[model samples]
Target: MEQTEITEILNRPYARELLGRDLTRLAYVAADGTPRAVPIAFTWNGAQIVLCTTRNSPKLPSLRRNPQVALTIDTEVHPPKILLIRGRAELDDVDGIPEEYLQMNGSYRMSAEQRVEWEAEVRSLYDGMVRIVITPTWVKLIDFETTLPSAVEELVRQRAERQNA
Candidate 1:
């Protein structure tokens, strides 16, 4: 898709809302050439989606083997709002917790004491983590009001044509 098309899709209000969501499913090709999809917390930092994971995560090797990935952020509802993105993943190893990780989990209702405990646990768990940063190459936003799945849209059009005929 053209950059203009991708920008339009990503810029939609519904798409922006989805990007603000806390979780997105990241899909990538596994090292053995199979597809793998996993739910992960992420943050949209204006330019890219940033996700943090342990250095020994199973997905890391696969990502190294195949950087091309797709991300889906959607809600479970009658007419779901979905933001679909295709991107290339780049791994960045960092020494400390990334700010995005904290921001993404900030919505959770945690008491002051609970928050401290959580932070301490996180600090002790890993010495370093890998940030999987994805810069989208293509994007599509599907909100029931503005867009539907291509197959369903086609079906609706076909039915209307038959009725007219």
Candidate 2:
């Protein structure tokens, strides 16, 4: 898709809402040549989607081997609103927790005291982390109202042609 088209899709209100969501299913090819999609917390900066993981994370090796990835951020409601993204993962190994990691998990409901405790625990747990950054090269939004899955859209077109016939 053209960059402008991708940007237009990402700028839609529903797409923006999905991006604001706490978790996205990150899909990638594992080292064993199998597909894996795991739900992980993420933060979408206007241009890129950022995910953080422990330094020793297994997925890191898989991602390093095959940087191509897809992400799905969707709602659980009927006629789910889904934003699909395709990009290449860029791993940045950092010495300490990235601020984006803190921001991504900040949406969880917690008391001020619990929040403080949680941060402390996180700080103590990981000596460093790997930041996975993906800048969307392609994007799509499906609300099932104005848009739909490609197969469904094709079926709709076939039905219309039959009616015309």
Candidate 3:
């Protein structure tokens, strides 16, 4: 999709709500060519979606080989709000705990002391991290208002035609 179209979709209120969320299901091609989807913490940095992983993560190799990926951020409530994105993953290896990781995880509900301890633990555990940055090539927001599922949209059209007939 065109960048302007994508920006319009992403700027919608429903899309903004989904983007505020901390988790998304990251779908990618596994090393053996199978498809895999895993829940991961992500942050939208205006232009790109950022995901952090251990430097030695197995998925890194797969991502490096095939950067194409899809991500879904959705709500569990009835008539769920979903933001779907298709993007290319770009991996960047950083020397220390990535600030993006910290920023993405900053919303976790924790006490002041717990937050400090957690940060300390994270700092000590991983020598470095890989930031998987994804710039969306296509985007969709399904809020059942301005947008609906494909089947539902078709049904709505058919119903309207019948009513007119």
Candidate 4:
């Protein structure tokens, strides 16, 4: 998809809400040739989606082998709002916790004391982390209002045709 189209979709209010959400399902091919989708914390930095993980994360190898990935951020409410994104993962190894990691996790509800303890624990546990960065190449937003899943859209069109007939 064109960059402009992606930007427009992402700029939509619903899509922006999904992007503000803390969790997204990162989907990629596993090393064993199976598809894997796992919930991970992420931050959307205007131009890229950044997910931080341990340096030794199992998904690291798989991502290195196949950088292509898809991410889904959606709501659980009826007639859900979903933002789907496809991109190529670019791994960046950085010393210490990435700011994006801290920023993303900050959304979780925690008391000030609890937040301090958690930050300490996180800092002490990992000396470095890998930033799994993805610059979205394609995007789709399904609000079930202005948009929907492609198959559902097609079905709606067919139903309309039948009604007209």
- Per-prediction TM-score to the true structure, in the order listed: 0.94, 0.99, 0.96, 0.99
Across 17-83, the per-residue lDDT of candidate 3 in tens digits comes to 8999999999999999999999999999888999999988999999999999999999999889999
Give a tens-digit lDDT track for model 2, residues 48-141: 9999999999999999999999999999999899999999999999988899999999999999999999999999999999999999999989
**Which candidate, 2 or 3, has the higher TM-score?**
2
Clashes per model (N, Cα, C within 3 A):
0, 0, 0, 0
Residue 51 displacement in candidate 1 (angstroms): 0.6
RMSD values for the candidates in order, in angstroms, are 1.3, 0.5, 1.1, 0.6
Ordered by TM-score, highest first, the candidates read 2, 4, 3, 1
Model 4 CA deviation exceeding 4 Å by range: none
lDDT of each: 0.90, 0.96, 0.95, 0.97
lDDT accuracy of residue 95 in candidate 1: 88
Runs with alpha carbons beyond 4 Å of true place in candidate 3: none
Predicted structure 4: lDDT: 0.97
